[model samples]
Target: MYNALMGTAATTAVGAGLTLYYLEKNSAHANMEAEGLHPADYPFPQKKLFGTFDHASIRRGFQVFKEVCSACHSLDLVHWRNLVDVAYTEDEVREMAEEFEYTDGPDDKGEMFERPGKLTDPIPRPYANEEAARAANAGALPPDLSLITKARHGGVDYIYALLTGYCDPPAGVEVREGLNYNPYFPGGAIAMAQNIFDGVVEYEDGTPNTASQIAKDVVTFLNWAAEPELDDRKKIGAKALLLFSSLTLMALWIKRNRWHTLKSRKIAFNSPKNWNKKPNPPSKN
Candidate 1:
C-alpha cells in the first residue's frame, strides 16, 4: 500500500510539473511573438565526419578575435601552442606569444614579475578578475569565447545571427541606455554594442573583411576552439566505420562460401513400407 501511494504521488507531481512547464513555454512563445521577435537563422557551414576544417577561415577568425573580441572577452581555455601548425607557424606563434606581457615568478627575490608569454601559457585576460571585467563593462560580464559556440542554444548559427543582428529597435520600442537592439538576443536588447563592421579588421590574406564575413569567421574560430579535436574525432570515426564495414563484408562472404554446399545439396526421402516391400519382391525374384 505504501509503495502504491508513493508511486501515485510521484505520478501526480510529475504531471503537475509538466503542465506548468507547458504553460510557461507557451506564455514565453506568445510574449516573443508579441514583441516581434523570432528565431534568427544563419547558414552555418556544416562539419562532416570525413571533412577537415577550413584552416584559412579559422586563421582569419583568430585574427578577428585577437584584434576586436579580445579587448573585452577572455579566451583563457586556449593556449598559444594550440595555434601552432593550425593557425600559425612555430616562429609566428612564438612571436605572437612574445607580444603579450605575462607575469612570471621571481628567481631570488621571491617576487612575481612580468615577462613575455610562452607557448604553454593560457590566453591573456582583458582584466585582472571578474570584478574588474564587470566594472569595465557596466556590470555585464563578457562570456569566454572559447566555448561560446557550444554553450549557446543554436551553436554557430545563433552566434552568427547575434553578431550580425544589431540594428535600430522597432517602432514603439524604446531601448535603454547602454543597451543595443538585436533580434537574435532573447529580450531584443543586448549589452554588447555592434562589434562587427565592414573593414573592422584588415584580413591578412586579402579577403574582403565585410561585417558578415567577420561574424562568420569569428564564429567558426569559436566553434573550432570549443571542439579542437573535431578533426581527429572525425578522422577516427571514419576509419573505424571503414574498418567495420570491410570486416562485415568479409564475414558475409565467408559465411556464404561455407554454407554454399549444404544450401545447394539435394536430398531424397522414401517410405518405410516401400523398403519393406522391396525385400519381399527380391525374395520372390
Candidate 2:
C-alpha cells in the first residue's frame, strides 16, 4: 500500500507539472503571436554549405555603403586594403583610400598633422565621439557596421528585414512620433527610420538601384565585412574534407585486406612427441 500510494502520488505530480509546462509554453507562444512578427527567412545564396559570395553584388554593396550608409553608420573594422581583390582592384582601392584624409602623428615641430588615408587605415567614423553621434540622432548612437551581421540576433536576414520592413502600424497599435514601425524589431518600433529607398545609390556596374537590390547588396557587404576570411575558410574546409575522405577510403581498403588475413589465419598446436620421437628412440638405443 505504501509503495502503491507513493507511485500514484508521483504520477499525479508529474502529470500536473507537465500540464503547467504546456500551459505556460502555449501562453508564451500566443503572446508572441500578438506582439510582432519574426524576421523573414531570406534566401541568401552565400549562406549555403558550399556556396560562395557574389563578388559583383559585394562590389555594388560597397558602392551603396559609401554613398548611403556612410553618412550615419561606420565601418571601423574594415580597412581599405581589404577591398583589394574582393571588391576593388589595388589601384582603385588606393585612390579610394586617398579620398579620405587621416590624422597623422605629431611632426618634428611637436604638432599633429593631417595626411591622405592609406590602405592600412581603418574606415573612418562619421562622428568624432559617441556623444556627438547620439546628439545628432536624438540620443540614438548608430552601431558600427563592421560586425553588424554577426552581432544581431538573426544576422543578415534580420538587418535586411529591418531595412525593408517599415510599414504602417497595425490597428490598435500606437507608435511614438520619433520611432518608426518595423515589425522585425523588438516591440515593433525602432529609433532609426527607414533609410533605404529606391535610387538611394547608383551602381557603377550598372546594376539596378532598386531598394531591395540596394539592401541586398549592402547586407552582403556587411556580411563579408563581418567574416572576411569566409572564402578562404570555405576553400580550406573543402580541401581538407577531400584529402581526409581519400585517406579514409585508402585506410578502409588497407584495413580490410590486412585484417582479413589476420582474422582468417589458422592456429594449431603440434604434438611435441611427433618431432622428438626419433631422438628419444636414438637416446634409448
Candidate 3:
C-alpha cells in the first residue's frame, strides 16, 4: 500500500514539473500578444523622469529613507562608498558614511579609528544579518534595496509607483485583512503600510511638503543608488559602440579580400582556356 501511494505521488510530481516547464518556456511568447500595462493604469502616478538620476529627487529620497523606511528596511547591499556617485562630493559622502556604524575594527594603536567609509562600503544593516531580519518580519524577509530598482518589474517605474500608490479605503477594491491597498503594487495590495505623508520629513532644500513630491524624490534616490555609474556607463557604451563599428568595417574588408582570393582561385581552375572538355550537366532522378 505504501509503495502504491509513493508511485502515485511520483507520477503527480512528474506531471506537475512537466506542466511548469512548458508554461515557463512559453510564457514570454504568451505575453508577447497580451497588452502590456503601465504603472499609470493603476492608482499610482508614474514618474516624469526615468532611466536617469535626478539629483534633487535623490536628495529628497535620502531624507525619506532616513526618516521612515530606514527604521525597518535596511540597505545592506549599498555601501557608504557608493553614495559618491549620486552627485555627492567626496566630503559629503564621507560625512554620510560616518552616520552609519559598521562591524569592522582597527589595529593595535588602542585608539578606535573611526572607519571612514570608502566609495565601495556595502550599506550596513540595522539587523545583524538576514537571519535577524527574517526573525523580525515573521519569516517574511524584506528585500535589499541596492539592486531592487533593477530586480523589480517595470524596474524604476514599479518602485515609483509602489511608493506613491499607497492609500486607505480604496474604492471598488476589497483588501485582505492584514494587507493594505497599494495600487502601484503588482497585485494592488501589500503588507507594508502607506509610509509617506506631507511634511513627514522637513526638507532644508525648500522642496514642498507633499506626498507625491516626497515619493518621487525617494524613488529618484533609489534609482541612483541602484546605478551610481549610469552617466559614465552611457558614455562608455557610446565609445564602445563607435570602436566596434570601426573594427567591424575592418573585418568586412578582410573578409572581402579572403572571398576575392577564393573566387580568383576557382576562376583560374575552371577557366575555359585551362579546361579542354565540356562539363556534363544532364542527370536522371
**lDDT per model vs. reference:** 0.86, 0.88, 0.70
Question: Model 1 clash pairs?
Answer: none
Best-matching candidate per TM-score: 2
lDDT of 3: 0.70
lDDT of 2: 0.88
Q: Stretches of candidate 2 above 4 Å error?
A: 1-28, 33-36, 272-285
User: How many residue pairs collide in each prediction?
Assistant: 0, 0, 7
**Cα lDDT for residue 112, candidate 2:** 91
For residues 1-285, could you state the per-residue lDDT of candidate 2 as single tens digits?
999999999999999999998765444454452455556678888898887888998999998888888888999899999999999899999999999899998899989999998889988889999999999999998899999999987788888988899999889889988898888787887888888999988778788899999999999999999999988899999999999999999999989987998988999998776775555454544
2 versus 3: better TM-score goes to: 2
Cα error, residue 263 of model 1, in Å, equals: 6.3
Residues 213-249 of candidate 1 have per-residue lDDT tens digits of 9998998899989989988888898899999999999
- In model 1, where do residues sit more than 4 Å from their true spots? 1-29, 33-43, 262-285
